[model samples]
Target chain A: MYQFNLHAILGYFGQLPSSILVTLEITLIALGASTLLALPIAKARMSGSRVAALLARAYVELFRNIPLLVLLYVYYFGLAQSGLHLSNFWATILALTTNAAAYGSEIIRAGYSAVPTGQREAARSLGLRPAHIELFVVLPQVVRVILPPFANHCIGVLIGSSIAAVIGVADLSDWMLATGSEAFRYMESFLVAAVIYIGLCQGVAAAMAALDRRSRRGAY
Target chain B: MFATGSVWDYWRVFVNGLVLTVELSFIALVLGFVLGMVIGLGRTYGPHPVRLACLVFTESFRSIPPLLLFFGAFYGLSYTTGVTLSPFQASVIAMVLEASAFISEVVRAAFRSVDRGQWDAARALGLRFWPALRTIIGPQAIRVLIPPTIGVYVAVLKDSSFASIVGLVELTRAGLLVRETVGDSLTVFLLLSGIYFVINFTISSGALALERRFRFAH
Candidate 1:
C-alpha cells in the first residue's frame, strides 16, 4: 500500500505564491484582452455591413472550433518558426485571448440582442451620438446580462491557463508537476494544487455573485 | 512558403492518430451520457440528499480544471492504488468522469424544461413513471437536450487533445511527431488546427441548423 506523505510536498510550499500569481496574471490579462477584442467583434457582427459581419462571424467560428491547446502550440511554436519568437507566457496570453474572445463575442452579441431595438432607436432620437448610445444607453443594460456568463468565461480562462504548463510556463500546475516528480509524491502534490485551484475559482465565483446581486439591487 | 510536401509524408500517422482521437471521444461521450443520465435523473427527481450529492459532484468537477483530473488519473491513481492505468485508459476515464459532470446538468435542465403539467397528464392517464417518461416526457425533453449536448460533444472533442499530454499519441501528438520529423512547426500546427476546425465547425453548425428545425417544429 502507498503511504501518504504530506511532508514531502511541504518543502515546496514556498513556490505556491509565485505559481498562483503567474496563473492569476495570465487569467487577468487574457480576460481583459478578450473582453476588449469581444467589443469590436460583437459590434461588427451587429453592424450593417455584410462583409464586416461575415468577417466577424468567420473569426468567431474559426477560433471557437479550435482547441486552446492547439492554439497555444500555434502561437508558441508555430510563430517561432516564422521568426516571431514569443516567450511562453506571452504566447499563452495571445492564444487564450484570441480563443476566448470568440466566445466572449457570442456572449456580448446575445446581450445586445436581449436589449430591444426600440431602446437603440430611442437613444438615437434623443440625439445621442452613436458612440454615446452604445456606451451610455446599451452598455448599462448589457452589463447585467453579460456579467454571469462573462464570469464563467473568466473562470474558464483560469482553468484554461492551467494547460499553459504544457508549454513550460511556471504556473500553478507547472509547479505541481515539478514538485510532484521531484518528491515522488504526485498524489500529494496534486491534492495541494487542486485545493488551491478550487479556492481561487470559488473566490472568483463569489466575487461575481456579489457583483450580480449589487447590479440587481440597483435595478430594483 | 507553406510546405505541404514534407508534412504529407506522415499521412498514415495522422490517420491513425485521428482514428484514436475519434475513438476516445466516442467512448467517453457514450459512457459519460449514461452516467450523466443517472446523475441527472437523481438530481431532478431524487430526495434532498441525492440532490445535494449530485450538486456537490457536478460543482466540484466543474470548478477544478480537467487537466488536473487527467494528472490525477494518470499519476495519482498509480501512486495511491498500485494499479497503473495505460495512458489511453487513463485519458478515457478522466474525460468520461469530467464530461459526465457537465452532461448531468444538461440532462437535469432538459428534463426540467418539460412542464409539471405534462407529468400530471401522464399520471392521470395511469402510465407508470418510466413509461410516462419514455412515452410522453422524453420526446419533449429531447428538443432541449440535443443542441447543448452537441455543445458538450464539441467540448469533449476539443479536450481529447489533452490526452496527448499524457502520452496517448492522438491527433495533436501525431502532429507534434510529424513536426519533429519535418521540422516545420507552423505547417504542422496549422494543419492540425484546420482539421480540428473542419470537424468541430461541421458538428456545431449542424447542431445550430437542427436547433432551428426544432424551434420551427414547435
Candidate 2:
C-alpha cells in the first residue's frame, strides 16, 4: 500500500493563501461583469422588440452552448492572432464573464417573470413613474426571486474559475498541479485542493443562504 | 492575418475527435444513469448507512472541481495504486462520477416528488417494493427525471472537453493540435466552438421536443 504523505501536503499550505485569493478574485470579477452584462441581456429578452429579443436569445444560446475552456482558449490564444492580445488573467475573466452572463440572464429573466404583471400594473395605477415603479416595485421582488439561483450561480462561478488554471492563471488548480509535481504527491495535493474547494463552495452556499433569508425577512 | 479557409483542410482530424467526444459522452451518460439510479434510489429508500454513503458520494463529487477530479483519477490513482489508466478510461471514469453525482440528486428529487400517497396506494394494492416502483412510481418520476437529465448530459459533454488536459485528443484537444500546426488559433478555436455549439444546440432542442411530447395534463 502506498503510504499517506501528510508532511509534503502540509508543507505546501504556505502557498495556498494567495492562490485562494486568485480564485476568489477571478470568481468575483467574473460574477460582477456577468451580472452587469446579464441585466441588459435579460432586459432585451423581455423587451417588446422582436429583433432585440432575438439578438438576446441568440447571445444566450451561443454562449450557453459553448464550453468555458474552449471560450477561454479563444480569448487567451485566439485573440492574440487577431492583434488583440489578452493576458491569461483578463482572458479568463472575459471568457467566464461571457459564459456566466448567459446563465445569469436566464436567471434574471426568470426572476423578472416571477414578478406578476399585476404588480407592475398595480404600481402604475398608483401613479408611480416608470423608473420609480421599476426601482421600488419591481427590483425588490426580482432580487428576492433571483437570490436562491443567483447564489447557486455564484457557487458555480467559484468552481468554474478553477478552469482559469488551464491558461496558467495561477489559481488554486494551478497551485495543486505545481504542488503535486514538486512534492511528487499528486494524491495529497489533490486532497488538499479538493478540501479547499469544497470548503469555499460550502461557504458561498452558507453566505448566500443567509443573505436570502435576510432579503426574505426584509420583504413585506 | 486570418487563415480561416485553411481550417477545413484538417476536417478528417476534427471529425475523428468529434466522434470520440460523442462516444465518450454517450458511454459516460449511460453509465452515469445506471450509477446515479442506484445512488438516488439508495439515498431515498435505503437504510441509514447507505443513505449517508450516497449523500457523501454525491456531495463530494459535486463539490469538487471536475478538473481536479480528472487529475485525481488520472494521476492520483496511479501514484497510490500502482495501476495506470489510459487517458480515455480516466476521463470516462471522472466524467461518470461527476455526472452521476448530479444525476443522483435529480433522481432523488424526482423520486421524492412522487407523493407519499402513491407509495401507500401501491402497498395497499399488494404491490411489493420493486414492483411498486417499476410499475407505478417509476413512470411518474421519469417525466421529472428526463429534462434535467438531458441538462446533465450537456454538462457532461461540455466538461468532457476538460479531458483534453489529461492529454486525450478529444475535440477540444484536436483543435489545440490543429492550432499548433495551422498557426491560426482564431480560426481553429472558432471552428471548435462552432462544432460544440452545433452538437449541444441540437441535443438541447431535441430535449425540449421530448419534454413537450412527454407532457401530460394532470
**Which candidate wins on TM-score?**
2
Q: After superposing candidate 1 on the true structure, give the runs of residues whose Cα lies further than 4 Å from its correct spot.
A: B1-5
Give per-residue CA lDDT, model 2, range B145-191, as digits (tens): 99989989899999999999999999999999888777889988999
Model 2 residue pairs with clashes: none
Q: List model 1 lDDT by residue over B114-192, tens digit each.
A: 9999999999999999999999998998889999988999999998998988899999999998887888999999999
TM-scores for chain A, candidates in order? 0.96, 0.98
Candidate 2 lDDT, A6-104, residue by residue in tens:
796788889899999999999999999999999999999999999999999999999999999999999988899899999999999999999999999
Best model number under lDDT:
2
Candidate 1: deviation at residue B148, Å? 0.9
TM-score of each: 0.96, 0.97
Off by over 4 Å in 2: A218-220, B1-5
Per-residue lDDT of A200 in model 1:
92
